[model samples]
Target chain A: MNTTRRSFLKLMGVSAVGLSLGQLGFDLAEAQAYASKLKIEGAKEVGSVCPFCSVCCQIIAYVRNGKLVSTEGDPDFPVNEGALCAKGAALFSMYTNPHRLTKPLYRAPFSDKWVEKDWDWTLNQIARRVKDTRDKDMVLKNEKGQTVNRVDTLFMMGTSHASNEECAVIHQAIRSLGMVQMDHQARV
Target chain B: MPKAFLVDTTRCTACRGCQLACKEWHDLPANATKQRGSHQNPPDLNPNNLKIVRFNERMTKEGVVVWNFFPDQCRHCITPVCVDVADMAVPGAMIKDKKTGAVLATEKSAKLSPADAKAVAEACPYNIPRIDPKTKRITKCDMCFDRVSAGMQPICVKTCPTGTMVFGEREEVLAVAQKRLAFAKERFPKAHLVDMEDVSVIYLLAEEKEHYYEYAGFM
Candidate 1:
C-alpha cells in the first residue's frame, strides 16, 4: 500500500488516543457515555437535487428503514462543492416543516378563516377565476387595429421551487390562457 | 495528531449556515425568536443553540460602516478552564477527548448545582457553556465528536458555504490558519489569529477583537 507520511499520521491520529482527560486525572466515563453511535451510521445515502433557487445543488439524503434520517450537500458535486447556503442547509427542516401546506386551503370571499378543500375543488375554482378574468380583461386588438391576444388583468407568478420541466409547462399553460404579465418568484 | 478548527472570519458572510447546520445535526429544537433589528437571532448561545453566528456592526474613524460576523462556539481549549471548574464540582461533568482534543460536556454535569454550573460557564474565556434550565446540565459545542469519530467533518464545517470553517489535524489546520492570516493581513492590516495557542479552534480575525465580540478572545 502507498502509505505516505501524511496518510500514516492520519491513521495514527484515528487509531490511537495518546492522552485523555482520564490520564490528566479526570473521569471520562460520563463523557464516553455521551459519545453515542453516529445517527447516519447504518443509513443509506441517496443522491437528490436541492429544490431551492436556480443553483440546484446535489444533496445526499441518508435514509434508514425507508425514512429520511439526514440530508447534506454532496461533496463530489462541482457547483456547491459540498457547501450549502442557509436555505440549502435547512433542507431537512424544510422537508419536515409542520407548517407546510399539504392540502389546499380555501377562504371564502368574505370569510376570515381558510378551510381545507380538495384538489379538484381548488383547481376548478382557479380555472373558473382565470377564465372569468380572461373574458373580462382580454385585449384582442389595440388602437392601431392589430391583434394583441393578451389579458391585461391576469398575471402569472412562477415559483423558484418548480423544476425546469415544470416551468416550461407552466409557461405554456399561461400563454395558452392569453396571460402576458408573467414574472418568477426567483427573480425577486 | 489532535484535531483542530480554523475559523477564517474573513470568508464568513453571516449566512448562518453553520448555526442552522449545527442545530440540524444535533436535532436541537428551535428557540422562539423575534426580529431584534439584527440578523443575529436568539441573541446568544443557549441550550438549543450550541453554535451561533454573531453579528457586529461599527463605524470606523474614517466614517466607514464595518460589519463583522463571528461564528461563536466552544473553543475546546487546550487546557480548558471549564473542565477544571466543572471537575471541581462534578468530576465527570466535562472531559477532553485525547485524540481530537475535543472538550465535551456529559450528562453527569446535571449533578452540578446552579451556582457550580454558573461558575463553570463563567470560567470559559469565550463565554461559552450555557446551563440548560430544564436539564440543569452544562451545554456547549462538543466539536461533533460522534461525527469526527466516524471520520466525518463537523456539521458546521461541512455546511459552511463561504469556506469560513476548516477542520483537520492540528498541524495542518494551524498552517491553514497562518496562511489565511497572511492573506487577510494584506487586506486588513490588523488581521490576527485569536488565542490560537490556547485553543483547538483558532479564529482568524481580520480586524480588532473589539469590532467582533467582547469575548472573541481571551482577556
Candidate 2:
C-alpha cells in the first residue's frame, strides 16, 4: 500500500491506541458521556442584551476562553424577567451567523452588488450625502407661508436594538438635520 | 415528591417564548425554516428543538372557526416505558433521575445501535425522541437535569410569561394542577388533566385530548 506521510501518521496513531487496549473494543459510551460533560463545564458568563426587538431582553452569554459557548435569558432582568421570545432566543445565532457583516457595506444607487467600505470612508460618504440632501431639499416655508425648517430628502430609520440613551441621541441628531420623517423597527 | 407541569392551553397566546427559551437553555442551533402558512416554524420537533407549540384550526359544532395552540414536549412519564426499553438495550442509555424524577437520556445512548435506538424511540407513547444522523445520538428533553440539580426551574417553565407552564415538587404541582383543573372545568366542561397519574408533566387541556394533539394522551 502506497501510504502518504499523512496516511502513515494516521495509521500509526490508530494502531498505537488500538494496541494499548488489546481485546476490548473502544469505550465509546464513556467517551460520549465525557463529551456531554465537557459542553457546559467550566464556562464563564458575560452579560448581554438581546438585539431582536423592543423587549430588549437581557441575556447571559457563556464564554469559554473568550469563545461564546452558549447564551440564555438573564434571570435578573426586570423587563423580560428571564423570558425570551423566539427572536430574542435566537441572539446567539444572530451574533455567530456566518453571513453577519463585519464591515460596512455600500451599494451605489441602482447597483446590485455591495462593496465593503472602511468606517472612515463610510462615515464621510454618509456625512457628505446628508449635507448635499439637506442643502438641496431643505424646505424653508409651506404654502401657508409658515417657517418650516424641514428636510424631505432624508428619512431616518432607527433600530429596535438601540438603548434608551442611544435612541435619544439619534432622535436629537435627526432633528438637528431638520428630518421630520422618522420611524423605528420597534413599532413593527 | 414528583415534579409536575401545568400547561394551560387556554392561556397560551402562542408567543413561542417557551419554545425559544428551551432551545436557548439547551444551546441548540437554529433550523432552516420557511413560511408554512402557520406561526409554527420547522413544522415539528427535530434534534435542535425540544419544545414546539403546535397550531391547529378547526370549526366548532356551531360552525365557528377556532384555533388551538398545543405546546408539545416529553411528558416525563412517571414509569417511563422509554427508560425500560432503553435499559434493556443499553443499561445506562436512559435513566430516571431519582432526585427530580426526570427521565434523562444519558450520552451513553449514543452507543446504542440504530435498531436499538429506534426501539427505544418507538417505546415512547408521545414519540418524543429524535436520533441525530450526524451524531448518531438519541436526543430529547432531559427536564433540564443540570438546572434542576442546581435548584433552578427548567428554562421553559421559567420563561413562560402566560403561566401556561409550571414546575415544582411533584405533590405541589399536582395540587396546583387540581386547583387549575377545577377552575378550568367551570368554563370548559371538557377540561381535564391528560394521563395525570402516568406522567410527571401533567397537561391541563381545556378540550378533548384529540383536539389538542393525536398523542396528547396514551388512550
Q: Which numbered prediction scores highest in lDDT against the true structure?
A: 1
User: Each prediction's Cα lDDT score?
Assistant: 0.86, 0.79
Which regions in candidate 2 have their CA more than 4 angstroms from the true location? A1-46, A141-146, A159-168, B32-38
lDDT of 1 at A97: 85
Question: Candidate 1, clashing residue pairs?
Answer: none
What does chain B score (TM) in every candidate? 0.98, 0.97
Which CAPRI category fits model 1?
acceptable
Q: What is the TM-score of chain B in candidate 1?
A: 0.98
Give the TM-scores of the predictions, in the order they appear: 0.86, 0.83
Where is model 1 more than 4 Å wrong at Cα? A1-28, A46-58, A131-148, A160-166
What does the lDDT read for residue A112 in candidate 1? 100
Give the clash count for each candidate. Answer: 0, 1
Q: Write the per-residue lDDT of candidate 2 for residues A91-182, one digit (tens) a residue.
A: 77777889999999989999999999999999999899899999999999998999999998799988877878998999999999999998
Question: How high is the DockQ of candidate 2?
Answer: 0.17
